[model samples]
Structure formats: C-alpha cells, structure tokens
Target: MAKAYRKDEFEFFQNQVGKIDQRVKSYLEVAGFEKWTWVYAPVNRGRMMTSNLAECINGKLKQARELLIIEFLEEVSASSTHIYSIYDEGKKYIVCLDRSPFSCGRFQLDEITCERAITVLKNKHVVDMKPYCSEYYYPEILRKTYDQSMFPMPYKKEWIVPQEVIDEVVLPPKYKRQPGRPKKNRHKK
Candidate 1:
C-alpha cells in the first residue's frame, strides 16, 4: 500500500489487508491515508521508499562494519551499459559498468571504481580511469584548492588583544565518565 502509485492499486492492497485483519485496516484508516499511502502523499519521495537508503547502506556495510577504521574507510571508498558476472574462488559476483552501483558496494560508497569495475573496464579497453574517479581527485581541482596563499601566524607576544576580551573567564565543561570500558571508536553524529 505504501508503494502503490495509483488509488485503485492502493485500494486493492487495502482491501487485501482488510480481509486479513479488520483491526489493522481500521488503524490504518485512523492514521490517515496520506501518511502511509504513496498515492495520496503530498510530497514526491522519488522512487526511494522510507528507510530504503539506510537499509541499502546497512546491507552494503555488513562485511565492512567489522573492519578497522582505516580498512573500513578504504572499503567504503562502477560501470558500463552491460552487467558482468565475475567469479572468485567459487563465489560469483555481478558488475555493471554503466550503473552507479556494483554488487560489491565499494564503487557506490567510495565514489571510485572497485577492482571488479576496473577489471570490466580493462576488458572493455577503457584505459582512462579519470572518468570513473571522483572529481575531488582531479588535478585541476586539487590545484585550485591549494592555489590560495597561506600566511604564517605571528608569535603570541606579538599578537594584539583587547583588554575586556583578556579579562573574560572561560571554564572547562563539566563531564562525568560513565562506568564501563571506554569506546575506541569516535562518536558518530
């Protein structure tokens, strides 16, 4: 019902749900049709349903999540018009050069071509990887980023400060450490 794009389609699903449980149908009705049904939603959610991105990312990070930060970053950080099937040690993988996502998930996460994508590109005789790499890695962008001149700071004694500003008192924040082992990983936003 939430994915139903048309009123009739939504109604069909609603009817089916009603047949299964009248209480659920009543609850859905009380919750407002527009809130849960796509056909009546005022805002366009594109093709992505709620939690779709989160679920997809969670699925992708399943293996990488156990890795160290450096390895995780490396893993997180594809292809052509056709899909390619790749096999490694009896394990089969899929790669598509034209699509943004590969089955490995590295290409999508890092915005860079993964090894599988690279193999496909090599097979296609695509030598230049600049097109596949993120623009942040571009030489022009790098040069532009560091083109501005930087000046060295003067000694503390040579710095000028207002009398009123110097008199201001700033105290450290109060913190109580919680019992248990401290976390090694940085806190995420």
Candidate 2:
C-alpha cells in the first residue's frame, strides 16, 4: 500500500483482498480504496505523496525535537522565519477590467489578489475589487468544496464490476524500428 498504486494493480489487490475477509473489505471501502492517492488531499500536505517527507522532516527536526519544548519551538520558528520575506521583485502586471482573465506571474493564488493588481487598481482609483476577480476564487466556492458530503463506498462483495471491463485485454504499444541510422550527436532545434 506504501507504493504508488496503478489502477489495474490496485483493482487486482482489491479483488484478492475481497476473497479474504468481508469485514476488512468493508473497512477499505470506507477508506476510499480506489481513490486513496496521496495527491487527493493536498491542503498543507507539502505535496508529500510518500513517507520521504516525514523522513526529511524527521532528519531536520531530530535535534530540535530533543531540546526543551520552548527551545524547540523557538528553533522551529527561527527556521521558518525566512518564509515571511517576499522575493518577488521587478515583476509587472497588466490589470484591465476589459481583460476576461488578468494574470501576474509572481502570485500563484491569483493575479487580482496579488500586490501588483492592488497597485494597479489604486493607481486607476478603482474601489471594490470583488468584481475584478473570477467567481471561482470566491469564498463561497471554497466553502462549498468543504461542505460537500462524500458517502462511503460499499463492501467489495457489493461493488459493481462489469464482466467486459474485468476481462478486458490490454497490450503494450507496438515497437517500430526507424529506417534512418541512429545519430551519435544530439540535434539542436
């Protein structure tokens, strides 16, 4: 389960596990057996798709964790202090109401919410920025995303698997030998 699971392999594992215990299958069903990829929930997860992140953090914080609680907290705070500094410098933005989607390279969150957009708006004397940003970035959208309910899946015995899909044949791509002789030197565009 620690390894990155391919869809076909995961399905095979599910089928094998299904033959073992129904209770275990039920538990896995509730835990998103098919959709358990690490990238599914990326909020503040540091893009960690494996235990490598924990290993790296453990290594860096090992000495710090051994220190007194206050000292450890201070050390952690000191280590992350640099994140408060903004490195975006000499970047430009073209802010316009007519432009359907305004974009600035510096900000990942959104262009309209970035400092450059604010500066442009201030220069143009435009107030109330809610109209400038897309509705997709609105607070309501985030709230809705969090509010949705995802029901647990049924047990493996109850799972619906079509016979055609389960027995489908998959083949590797056909290899073709090029007519031209292989070049030793790399070609430049």
Candidate 3:
C-alpha cells in the first residue's frame, strides 16, 4: 500500500473493511462453518452495522489515530496531568464491554465509533481498530459534560438582554460633559 493512499482516511477505511471481510470468511471456513450468517445491521435498524471482525478492525484504526504521532516528541506532548490520567484511569474508562458500552438506541452508532474504542486500543492494535473508531459517541449528558470540560469558556447562549440593562445601561450613555458644576439658577423676585 502506498503512503499516499494510507493518508486518505476514507480510502483507508474502505481498504480495511475489505480486509476484515476476507478475514471473517477465512476464519469461518477454517472453523468448518463454510457459511454462517450473523447480524450485519446495527441495532434498532439504524445504520450501525456490526460484525465481530469488522468491529475489531475499526477499533484498531481509532487507537492509531489517537497516537497523535508528531514530527517531534513535543508535538505529541500534552499536559503531564492528562497523560498521567490516561495512563491511570484510561484503562478502566476503556474497559471492554460485552457489547460496546457506548452503542446507543439512536440511528448514529456504527461498527466504527469511539465508544467502542476499548476493543481496539485496549489491545493496542491500530489496523484492527480502524473500523471501530469515530470520535467516541457520548450519551447526551456525557456530550454536554464533555463540551463543558473541553471549552475553557462555556459558550454563552444568546439571550435577551435584561430590559433593565438595556434601558438603564446602554441607552443612557449620551451624557453631555458639563465644563463646570451646574450653576443654581437665581430666581428674580
């Protein structure tokens, strides 16, 4: 395989999907089941197709992408705290599930998704992981949590300015500067 083609992610995925299909066929035939049918459609009739071999391949790809290979060591460098956290709690966070912990009831889950990463990176095989990798899917709450954590400043949702602020603050800014204190007007009797 040429390096150029390897650099194109979709091309890489297509190739990977092919390779896995072949492996599954071989493994099944070798086990004396020349033909066996399993579920390819993802759960809930969504596009989230699943096949054991296919999932394995996708997972490997994600782990490789996570490697963050850099031109220099510093290129891959991140805060020590984060790196340590991944070294420590990441394993559990990535622990394998009977089925992918992240797969959901929605239409988006696929054979290759980040939620299923433990299956690929857990074993540290990237080629095997490719099919399973997409930015790990998150539950809505987790997605919100992740958004909050990653954003240094939370996005301030657009809102109606308080009427008090608009009427009192911004609208009253045309104060004319008086040269001296206001002179008391003398009433002529």
Candidate 4:
C-alpha cells in the first residue's frame, strides 16, 4: 500500500488486504488506508522497513563499537586505509562507466545530486573523489563548517549590549486555563 502511487494500484492493495485476512480488513476499517500509505506521511521513509541494514552494519562493526572512542576512530581509519586518491599512487583517474560506486553506502547522503555529480565527474575523466570525503561526503562544505568558530559565553565585563535592543520591554503571552482536569497523556485519536 505504501509503494502504491497510483489510485488503481492503491485500491488493488486495499482489496487484496481483505482477501488475505478478514481481521486485517477490520483493522484497516478501524485505522484507515492512509495509515499504510507512506507517501501521505510527513517524512519520506525510503523503501527499507526493517533493521536488517543496521544489523548488517552492526555485524561488521561488532568489535569496533566495543572499543574506546579513540580506538574506534583508529579502527575506522585503518579499515579505510585502502581508500585513497589516484593521485596518491601517481595514477590518473579512470572514467569507466562500469566502475560505478553504486550501493557502496556512500551515495545515500545526497542521493540524486551526489549520484548525478559523481556520474558527471566520472564521464568527464575527472579525479576519483570517492575517498577523502567526510560528514555528508562533501569536503568543501565540511571544511567550511569547521572553519567557523562556535562562540561560547563571554564574561559579563566583556559583553557588549545595544541600549535600544535591551531597553525594549516584552510581555509574556496571556492565556485562560481550561476548566476540566488535565489528562496525563495525549492519546492518539
């Protein structure tokens, strides 16, 4: 039902639900078909519906996560030691169409844009930029992010305040309290 983008396909799934299990039809009647429609949800949770991917990653990093943060970082760095720029080895980039890094788990960050950029760069016989990428796999953006200083709270004597900005008075919002006893938890309707 979630993958059903068309009306007919959606209806077909709805009808099929009743055929599979009578109890499911009753549940659907109570919950509504919109509940099963992923497209209607606020967030687009792509195709995956299980924790199999996480389990696979956890299986790979089973020993690493058990180590200390510094050790973990070292393990990660050691694991990707083989990943390097072609220039490092005194070699030029190869623009082979068959050398796509699809399903490499690196393209999931900025799906369409990154994939398109990679493909375009590969076609143009540019450098292999797969390695040396961090934090969303965009080095320029990552560098720019680290370049800025996170300003911490300064001493009161060092603080500078505009008189007009501080002088302006603001009133707290006014509200009337409800008469009924408040419910503890908000139950979904």
Query: TM-score of every model?
Result: 0.41, 0.33, 0.17, 0.28
Whole-model lDDT values for every prediction: 0.68, 0.52, 0.39, 0.51
* Total residue pair clashes for candidate 1: 5
Clash counts for all predictions: 5, 0, 18, 0
Question: How big is the positional error of residue 117 in model 3, measured in Å on the Cα after superposition?
Answer: 1.7
lDDT of 4 by residue, 1-189 (tens): 765533455668878988999898788668865567643443434322222333434444679988999999887676543222233134333211222222322232222223443655665666966442324547676688799789889998888999997899998899889999987997889
Q: Which candidate gets the maximum TM-score versus the true structure?
A: 1
RMSD list, candidates in order: 19.1, 25.3, 28.2, 19.9
Poorest 10 consecutive residues of model 2 by lDDT? 44-53
Ranking by TM-score: 1, 2, 4, 3
TM-score of 3: 0.17
RMSD of 2: 25.3
lDDT of 1: 0.68
Residue 142 error, candidate 2, Å: 2.3
Candidate 3 wrong stretches, greater than 4 Å: 1-94, 103-108, 115-125, 130-189
> Which scores better on TM-score, 1 or 3?
1
Better of 1 and 3 by lDDT: 1
Query: Per-residue alpha-carbon lDDT of model 2 for 38-71, expressed as tens digits?
Result: 2233332222123232343454567898899999
